[model samples]
Target: MTTHSLIVTGLAAGYGDSDILHDLDLTVPAGKITAIVGANACGKSTLLRAMSRLLKPRAGQVLLDGKSVHKTSPKELARTLGLLPQSPIAPEGITVADLVSRGRHPHQGLFGRWTREDDEAVRAALDVTKTGDIAERNVDELSGGQRQRVWIAMALAQETEVLLLDEPTTFLDINHQIEVLDLMTDLNQTRGTTIAMVLHDLNLAARYADYLIAMTAGRVHVSGSPETVLTEDNVRQVFGLESRVIADPTSGRPIMLPLGRHHVTQA
Candidate 1:
């Protein structure tokens, strides 16, 4: 890893009076993919926002490279950390290349002029995301999966060491979800990018993540390798759903099969 990235301690954040998160401590290993999973409203998105410096912590601190994130300049921070929220907006007429090029804003100078490095980064990001063929295409005209990939490409162009994503698989079908995760895995392996993503799909999380953090009601329920933390008992406790976790025949990692009421057999 080029840099030892984010360290968060006693981190608590939320909007207005209601406290969505209690004290939290987490250390993200550089260059590894960490997946955060939980039921809805478990502070998954808020945790990502806090680490990315979008949401202010009420009690504890989020440190990026040993420095307080609150003290870090936005441009400098942007250079080190990139975040992709669930749904990012592009201007109506924005081209894929134009939007991806905007990731270089952090690298710009006083006049914010574009540089060769910026152009190269944009092109490289497009190429890596496989959107180079559609570089001139309007972003609004793309499919949900393609649009998501474009947003990811824009984040990639920033060339940050640590990338955070919230619900990266929300709108996609099963195949595209796998596609995005595969792309992210490739990026992590190829560039040594440290990644932390919040995922709603437990199965996908287990399949793709190097590490998993299971959260419940704003606190970490358990964290470790998927095989360690994603057992049937843990799933029942954290997600409040009965499930049977078995080894995936292909991968050997944990695989959750939820047991719904309708699926229960009569005695």
Candidate 2:
């Protein structure tokens, strides 16, 4: 149950010539779930990519336990950090078992010998994600929800202490979104895995995240507990939307209720 620290210092990353993330400083609390939320193109995903070393930072560095993540060896980093991208591709005709087993690659040596531990890891991941029933099924053939869960299983099988996900709830229905988020919470609780994800749904982000980061124009507007960060003014300024923040009766978490022209009652 050792949780490692992740820090970003003066990080600037983007596509080619354009910088999507400015000089940003962030510290991910160990063993907690942190969600990054903002309007589209606000650099939520870009920040995530930089943190995971998928995108190179132009100005600064991402530090995992005080060491530069980009300078770490690929297999060593993979063993310590797992990333689920916004869109993950499974090779055509690959079975769920095979794809999940691929997560054990980091643990394997140059000889690539598969061990009983590998089998157990894949099985545990599948069972936890409720994808064991489809273990033999082709990943491409499953429904969107099932596919997403299976992909999560693969990440889980990696057995990393830190996990990063980019919009893990993308294309999911409300129920499936909750399912995946709840699963993430379970991972945080049971395994003490440090989880950081980019989420578009403000309400869901507030509900599930222990810490919420609100980004605006490639910079972090504010970050703290959901109740503190989801204030009306911050929401409006970051999202450019008029909204009311309410306490979710179930979890007592902050929930954003957008105010539209038609939804407002004239006094």
Candidate 3:
């Protein structure tokens, strides 16, 4: 359980001619769960992409343990930093076992043969994700929840110290969403893996994340513990909506209740 630091400095990145992330600076706390929340197209995913080296930074750097990610070799970087994008596409007709095995690619050489360690890693990942039962099933045939678990299993099999997830809970039902977030917490608790993820559900993020980051217009508007970051003023400024922040009885974290036009109480 080696701890690794992931830091972003003056990161400016985007697609085509538009920069989605503007001079963004962030430090992912080592061995902690960090959730990045923001409105649509607020550069949460773009920041993640830059950190994982999927998108090249226009200006600035993403560093893993003080080393530049852009300069690191692909295999070397993948071995230390795993990324699970919002929509991961599997090869047509690939079986669950085969797909999970792909996570071992970074550890294998060009002519390397599968070893017992690879088998054990894949087995452990599948077991933890509860996907072992469907190991031989076709990936495309599984339900959305099952498919998402399999994708997570692949990331787990990679065994990276630092993981970046872009909307990992997308398309999941409430139960499945809780299950996935709980699983991530388990990983952090057991393996001390550093995780940074983009989440849309503010309450869920507050409940599960040790740290919360709220972004607006390609910059981090506010970030800290849930109590510090999920205040009424921050929510109003970040989401452009009136909301009340209350302590969640279950988790004791702040949960936001949006106040729309219809829900009004006379002063």
lDDT, candidates in the order shown: 0.90, 0.93, 0.93
**How far does residue 8 in candidate 1 sit from its true spot (Å)?**
1.2
* Per-residue lDDT of model 3, residues 1-267, tens digit only: 689988889999999999999999888899999999999999998999899989999999999999999999989999999999989899999999999999999999898699999999999999989999999999989988899999999999999988889999999999999999999999899889999999999999999999999999999898899999999999989999889889999979999998888856841
**Poorly placed runs, candidate 1 (over 4 Å):** 264-267
Q: How close is every model to the real structure, measured as TM-score?
A: 0.97, 0.98, 0.98
Error of 2 at 220 (Å): 0.8
Model 2 clash count equals 0
Weakest ten-residue segment in model 1 by summed lDDT? 258-267
> Between candidates 1 and 3, which one is better according to TM-score?
3
TM-score of 2: 0.98
Which of candidates 1 and 2 reaches a greater TM-score?
2
